[model samples]
Target: MRIPGVPPAELAELNRAQDRLSFVYLERCVIHRDANAITATDEKGVVHIPAATLGVLMLGPGTSVTQQAMMLLADNGATAVWVGEQGVRYYAHGRTLARSSRLIVAQAAAVSHRDRRLDVARAMYRMRFPDEADTRALTMQQLRGREGARVRRCYREHAERTGIGWQNRTYDPEDFDSGDPVNQALSAAHACLYGIVHAVIVALGASPALGFVHTGNERSFVYDIADLYKAEVTIPVAFDVAASGSTDIGSDTRRAVRDRAHDGAILHRCVRDIRALLLQPGAAGPIDEAWLDEDAGDDTLRLWDDDGAELASGRNYAGEVDF
Candidate 1:
């Protein structure tokens, strides 16, 4: 899957750090390898996508990517997601970045502990409402009440400003076409946000099901994270697009959502916020010499030999520790 013409050192560097490219949206395109670059060809023209620098690739309906192009994306740590119309509905996703599992272990430990889970939930609420003096003390019920009120107010304000008729937030998953343009646009915009947040969650090696405020679903954590930016990002865009009376509201909504994500630096903020919420003060400390030294001893568990053969010699018997 290695691209030719690119030096090994440069490829190594690209894999080692985050890429400058944030997100790319493509639809009805054919992606394949073109020498050292991954090119996407459509009716418009053929364009090269710097897979190494890309954060997320949204493959909308009708997109066909070659196996070579997919392998290149995985090798470069870029996430590829198959989505529905206007990148609103997520269908599937590619491999995540291969990174340390320590962060995920820490997250699991926190969520498994009952009190710690509540604390994490409170921390999430505090993050969403930093100015509220009682955020830390508010119970989960209180937090939910406040969040509901706040969101309703946001909908009302946006509706008044944009002159779009506002009603209760409603959508039928079974019938996407049933909703009005505004409701449909909102659904589309939120789906895009979820896709972006899902990529970050996977990149960090965190569990999407292990959420703080949201639970029971596979993308519980994705929803929890996406909610933080909905007010500032998708809500306004949905309202504005609906107000414009555009024929293709979904496409317009996607463009606006992408623009907001870039302008607001939402991905960077998401990374920082995730760390702040999960890696709280004193929850875990820096790795020290002792931690590294544990792996240096010969008594360390070895499951396989250098030649890929299973080694049963290391198993401990009734009274003896085999080495």
Candidate 2:
């Protein structure tokens, strides 16, 4: 009944999504389980983190994590991500807390159907450009064009405002340092955003690859969702970091992005927006506010009924329906 390291210990009991921490980044440390908390020890010293409330544990370059630490994280429904060597790229991640297939099922249904896929893409565009009242009628190519122009204008405006150099948005995933300061900052900021969005998508039992706006890549849906906030979250931050002339652009950009995301209440809004996108259509009505607080591993399974209602699962209905 008690959560491990969080004060008063109430995570496993209540499992409130907002009660958890957004993320914690650790590098060049040996991480292991210490009592109810996780300990990260380095030449700098040792720090203890509340594993119960941790959402994503980003293990960066020169980091070593013990199996005991990983087990503790898994038990507490925490996500552990192994990041890039210089720490600006995403590599892999540990398990998510999702046990229900409701969101993923909805996502698959929408992605498989052509009209539903376009509708989801339009909904995303609407979320990005809330002022635009005619996104519903825009074709995919038109939507892309609008988005491209908007992003270009955003970059130009930010560059002018900050007095920072901006030629174009270019990132070499294989080499994070090949780009200039602004580009490096942008890449780092976006990686952080991608990590957060990917964490949320998997936590809600949605496929990060089955995207509506993007495709082919393993994290296509992560890109789709992260693009929703790039203009407001990462673009300006990257430019501002470059303007400050920070020697360590990656670290500074990440800190700025983290602060902005927190101040903007992005985590809460991310969950709410994801639910609005995937869980709305084919439902009886709008989802309640309490759905945002759903605990991982609730484990309710139902048969997908294309006709209407949710049928009971774990039964043979071969004789009841047609082939």
Candidate 3:
């Protein structure tokens, strides 16, 4: 997914060269070129993207392009265009633009909050350590105590509820070693959260760094959003799937662990939950328009209008391309 806010300055044009597009992250075997092919690089040293398969290149503001690249891009189906941090401003090819002040405001109001998400994360963590006397059923709100009694209660209860075998023991964060059941569950929870957040980032079309809730220099906006769904979806399923896959919850279980997180129904529910979260008023907020703008938005992001039309509000939309 793309970020909602653009960088403060113009992107640096590092280089431009011609290369045949082979499929990597390419979702489909389609490609387009706009006038001059410009290669942009962020300060983070991540390579800037070239034209994408099945996606039209929308030039940003102050963007320079050659007529030849533009002709090839448009003719080859660079569906629409966007200008600067704003959004889709034009349809250089056979595409349309959409967006409005009301829409932006609505989208900004729909993302979820940190405290609630942390609560959910804590819950998932407890489920994984069900048999531990010091870590189950504890909410983040109650995690501040040095004794961690609340967490212990939750863990004991979790063990009882799941009827799982466990060593009734106190969890000392320091005493834990690799491949311990508790640690394994926690790792799975983290991975599941990562996958879910990545999916959410893809859906929202917002930069994972420009987040609504979790914040830090090490920004993983995708991880933050996905954290919200872990307790509700990913964590539980991961545990069950992992246990079912192997008696030992170790590296051998990682694939099953990842697979449950990626299960179609679970992922779909997570996506639906994210969409619902983002659409709520001031909870998660509405979808960002920049996410849908061909210039700034990730083309994979999908938005719907009140009229049930599959389009980004106020930004022109190309026909839907199912992943």
Candidate 4:
């Protein structure tokens, strides 16, 4: 769900639509899909399509497309078509579909970036736990003494878990050392969990790649959300399960861990924190003291602190609508 080089505000507007049938994330392939005589085509080098409304989604270079299933999408008045690795150069009937796709891309981008603050927290969580901490606390020269030491302690505790390895930490991607069985297993598990996060984000009508904390290169905001639960959920569960002699992330174990995370209050706490951050008067844009009272509806919604105390009650939305 990443289309780089596009403006966040424009993307946010498109995402607010609740009735769109489907969206495309064509970052690597050219795609085409059709529904009710409406077809959209996404081509090379274009992150936002400016044509067609409902027919086809064409993927070229640097793009991706997602749907529950190809047949399902087509039946639902949509089509998912890919043009392979080399990328597509031409389509049978191009202009019409391309125009529609542009509009779709705009709307999709807006929806995807709707929750920037949640994106940030999720990314922070991922970079900190469950995914091996590559940097040693003591080794980071810039870190203050106490901060460095505390980070190291946490890192060591997390590193001891199974499915935690030292590939990115110690070796280059081109190096053969990355093939170690332990590292491979860790990578595989992390990948599966990442996918689960992506599915969750998609279900929530949120973008999976755009993030508040991580750079654009990572292309996995969902991975960030999954990372947040690492310390609070994934890492602990993984270590305990593995310590008991289970190594693989079998379907049952994966489901169990996911359910535990879902039911756990920590994630909710983090989400609430994120929501509050979003509600901050000046967080989205500039703060307007006069508009605060009128912006947030009175008593219709209430936000409690960790101790369950009311904070602020005035709505001050500015930049874009909340989804």
RMSD for all candidates, in order, please. Answer: 6.3, 4.6, 16.5, 15.4
Q: How much RMSD separates candidate 1 from the native structure?
A: 6.3
**CA-lDDT, candidates in order:** 0.75, 0.81, 0.39, 0.37
Ranking by lDDT: 2, 1, 3, 4
Cand. 2 Cα-lDDT: 0.81
| lDDT, model 1 | 0.75
- Candidate 3 — which residues are off by over 4 angstroms? 1-154, 161-179, 217-220, 232-234, 237-252, 262-264, 284-323
* TM-score of every model versus the real structure: 0.82, 0.86, 0.37, 0.37
Model 1 misplacement above 4 A: 1-12, 15-19, 282-323
Per-prediction backbone clash count = 0, 0, 34, 50
lDDT of 3 by residue, 1-323 (tens): 87663222211221101111211121112222323343333334323344322132434445444454444333332233432221112212222112223323333443244554543344333333445455334545554452245435644555555555545443333332334464455454454345334433332333445444455623345555554454444445434544454555533334444455445444444444444443333332334543333233233445766876665456644555454
Writing each residue's lDDT as its tens digit, candidate 1 over 120-201 gives 7777776677677656566889989989988999999999999988888999866667889899889988988898888877
Q: Candidate 4: lDDT of 206?
A: 39
> In terms of TM-score, how similar is model 4 to the real structure?
0.37
Best candidate according to TM-score: 2
Alpha carbon lDDT of residue 56, candidate 3? 29
lDDT of each residue in 1-323, candidate 4, tens digit only: 77654232222223211223222324344333333232233443323332222233434446434342243333333333343221112221111101112222332443356454433343343234425442232222332343335445654576665445433323223432344433333333343344434333332333445555444643345454555555456545544443455444333244445455446643334333223323333233433444322123332345456886855657654544566
Worst 10 residues of 3 by lDDT: 15-24
